[model samples]
Target chain A: MSAAGAGPGSREGHREPRRAVDGALRADTADTADTADTADTADNPGLAARVTTRRGGFTLDVAVEVAHGEVVAVLGPNGSGKSTLLGTLAGLFDPESATVTLADRVLTDTDAGITVPVHRRRVGLLSQQALLFPHLTAHENVAFGPRCAGQGRRAAGAVADRWLAEMGVAELADRRPSELSGGQAQRVAIARALAVEPDLLLLDEPFAALDVDAAPAVRAVLRRVVRDSVVGGQTVLLVTHDVLDAVVLADRLVVLADGEVVEQGPTAEVLARPRSGFAARIAGLDLVTGTACAGGLHTLDGTLVSGAASEPLDHGDPAVAVFAPRSVAVHRERPAGSPRNVVPVRLAAMEPQGEVVRLRAGASGRGPAWGEGLAADVTPAAVAELGVEPGDELWFAVKATEVAVHPSGR
Target chain B: MTRAAPSSPRTRSSRTGSTGHTLPWPVWVPAVVGFGLIAVPVAGLVLRADWPNFLTLITSDAALDALRLSLQTGLTSTALCLLFGTPLALVLARSDLPGLPVWRSIVLLPLVLPPVVGGLTLLFLLGRTGPVGQLLDAWFGVTVPFSTVAVVIAQTFVAMPFLVVSLEGALRTAGDRYEAVAATLGASPMTALRRVTIPVVLPGLVSGAVLAFARALGEFGATVAFAGSLQGTTRTLPLLIYLDSQDDLDSAVALSLLLVVVAVVVIVATRTRDASGVR
Candidate 1:
């Protein structure tokens, strides 16, 4: 994704790009280095599950695959069957007709009626709520899985101690859930999940409920854990609503809308060329639907906006042009440059975006009027030099190469 | 943090004085009557208790026999309630068995039924010449009436509802959240029940047991109706108090005070137990 305008805390605001790069690097290493030895298919090391479940009025039908050591993000809007997919993989619900194979081990085969129980599935699900056993101390909570798997008390305690240290919550071992902070509880939950040595780990918005100040620390721990597990053959599936989460942790993106997989590709590739409004919105890009022509597109606003497409499009084909706010140049007057397209618009609002300023320009020089608009992210210094304000008339320019045009889907 | 909503300063200042403004008589008067109705009788019972010779009267052979029998039967009755009531509570609270509402109503029958009526129902099932009782007598040579075991059974008949209802409410409130999580953590259903579910609802179970024991200790009508009053066998503390009222007023008051003290102890012990285990 195009980087978000760096906020006042510029380093933290730019966390997504830096993390996505690291994840991509690790993913590339894992893919090329170890594509052998599954005792079945040396080429395929990923776990695949084709889930189809009907609950209430929503029918969830999606196929998900995560390569060994690869982290895939199941990003979706609310009520998009994210939980249903995770629950079915974790063996909480039996899918109608599906096959779930994790590292060559079939966990669920509906046609064969071979559905392993939750405890036997060897799938670890850490939810938004920590769901720690309240009566158990952090250490005991971590030890529960090993103990249930027939370990002695001392052996289980040792296993718990090791994971607790690994999770960076070693000091919180004796503390109860109520005595622990939200982030601390979540870390312990992560340790608990790992102690089970699950083949497929489902992290369901583990940071969603955490405090803003604590999310970074938890995110760091999670990244380290996922990075370290590359050699251990553990596949991770992260379910999140936040694009930053997907951008930072997942190497691949699987976008779900209304219980269907709308898009799936490499994280950066899919993010840079979103086909849906939800995807574009999360990526923080302005999505303009236009009629594709030879060179660029003709927008519905009765204007010509020139942009490049990754692939050539046939004339009159419905397409979308996605561009970042930072790509737009805000000016007091029309400037002569190499810019391919320029639109005259009135400033609807100017919002402070960290070190940068984002100007919302619309057709009317009034507060948030109804019309086609462009979101322009410019430097605070530039805004001050131009003295931009609400209801100001201005012209914004964007190079054709900055906008990526792609075929729009129903 | 509450958002500071804009409001008139005068209105806020007036609201500060509203707490000082007494409640309307209609509301206050009925509330006082509700409190007084329950408090007045217990207060009178305490005030009328025989202070002098209370210890001496309770220590007498007849009173001692009844007190010992009541304690023994009450303990056994509460033990039985816990043994049976726990599973019943689990089934009622956790399962989705058909006819659940009807079964729940049937289970609550003893709670509202008169003690004498409950005793009669038990008699129909277990009394001599009764179907089950006849089978027991012919096969095992067991006669229930006028026996200490009968006293325990009668007390259980009258008091088991209190235990079951309390436990069911506890189990329902606790829910199966811990159990579900524990299963996902690799604990089998039975192991989860013992390790997670039981510990989570321990306070409820304790309170229920205490209430059942208290009810059993004071039971009189059911014991008299079903078990029959035989001194040192079925004559519990309440029966002793009823018997003493005819000849020894002082002993009757002393026995009543003892029952009240024991019930208070049970309540306080359970309260402390709950306070100590705050799950």
Candidate 2:
């Protein structure tokens, strides 16, 4: 444990010291106040990064911050520059322009011509693959970081054992990555990354490869480690597509779409009131962007969507109408009903969700479609009763009270 | 002892007397001819070998010396290949150096060049009258041509390309993701290569070394052209066999059989090791 503290980046040691108090998952700390270069840790207290890069047709420009001891999850769809952001932060991907400051260190500043090497950045990355050295056992894999930092063989082994115990994989210390299951290997990989005692831990879809049965256990392990990291004042940045990952692990959410930050807020707030199409889709909410009018909101196509304002908004201000799919009812024809908001739509797609079938309607399918992203949820029995298939001309009826309008946060 | 029949009797019955491996009828003709083109020469040598005197002919002093020198020089050249070629392979596969394609083409020259041309190139570089040879002569009164060291150099010149090409392909296939992961784990580039890259590609290195050793052992034109056939001094098994054929054909045939045995053993051993080493 003491040897683990002897990292090339002593700053990393200060961030996460090896602890062994509990049987295998000890919660202990080393008191080392040699914070000479870390004077700004209290002022900025976390990570501030602005990265921009262009490769071929794709361009990524993003700025994000994480408070000290906070976990910020970067949520994005595939090819949305999540990997680029993490790569630039970890110093693996060179950026055309970037200013990255973690705690007290300026890791990268293109204007200053300063780019910290990947190994010296003290930014540990746990990618989708565990990527443990195939030749090394779990114990040796964990010891590698300490050994690279100039610790003696015995000292590195001691550090490895302590970290392995902390990760609750002490019993698997002798097994190679090939012998370990996905969950076990990921656990060992976590220990290997933490053995370096990095200042920032970046998790890139750490549970994407695990099975449903194995993911929850790994998520629990990560939750415990993230909590420990918070106690040690270490910052964590998670990149994931799963809303559950953001809900369970992150303090803040930064949603990216098309290589830009489309929305970001507190995790709970963003989940409840997502502004971006990607965010709303993951949150299972239907969002239509328009301008607030006297009656409700007017879409760019001049279709009126009547709804109650969830927040105060001025007339002509950009607003969004949000409603759950379950709140919308599908009808074969315009019926004289209490629902005031009814629009003609063509069924575009259908997908089964646990107990209900979700039917989506788009503008391309049929007659005078009002909106493209309208959806409704109905039970299988209701679907059979309707006898609908894709391309069917349908009317989507929603009560004005069902839609909630709020400022678009544009 | 009674045994249970295979559960899928219909499938087993259909597979009777057939191993489930078949190629089109046209392929067997050229396949057999191509294999015979390689196998017939060794069959001829084995058939023509003086069986009663084969042991004594190969165990002769000059034959034994040539065998020893060939083994020694082949091993030394293989060692040299591994030492110098591994880094060259890494650079060719991983480095962003300008004109790397041209450099890789130059490194692969030995693979396609005639062994005589390779020998002549080495001679021009390291011969006594050559640039580097003149320096060695002036500085240390050393003569490289017609020496055992010259045999090793010629063999290494012709054999190293195999090692480098094999290893570079392995490096390319393995990719750098693991090294990047190691770097993030605080491993320096050199450390990552030593601990991660090298271990991951150990099978490639072993197979490459074996290929180089076999090529060095069989090197004929290069060793003869550069290092003259001086018995017990520079002549290797190939040179000895050539010289033996000028007089005693039995000795030459026996030695050829020895090389065939060595080459077969090396190739078979490498194939099995490769099969097991690769996950």
Each model's lDDT comes to 0.75, 0.79
What digit string (tens of lDDT, one per residue) describes model 2 on residues B157-273?
A: 999999998898878877888899999988899899998899888877888899899999999888888898999889999998998899988899999998888789888988777
Native contact fraction, candidates in order: 0.36, 0.51
Clashing pairs in 2: none
Pairs of colliding residues, candidate 1 = A7-A354, A8-A354
Off by over 4 Å in 1: A1-46, A229-233, A285-410, B1-35
Whose lDDT is greatest here? 2
Candidate 1 CAPRI-style tier: incorrect
Measured by TM-score, the strongest candidate is 1
Residue A19 displacement (Å), model 2: 38
Q: How high is each candidate's TM-score? A: 0.74, 0.73
Per-residue lDDT of candidate 2, residues A177-295 (tens digit): 76687788888888898888888989999999877887767776776676654237557899999766776677667888888777765564566545565786776866676788876
Candidate 1 lDDT over residue span A259-299, tens digit each: 77776655644564455656755667655656787777767
| TM-score of B-chain for each predicted structure, in order | 0.87, 0.89
lDDT of 1 at A84: 83
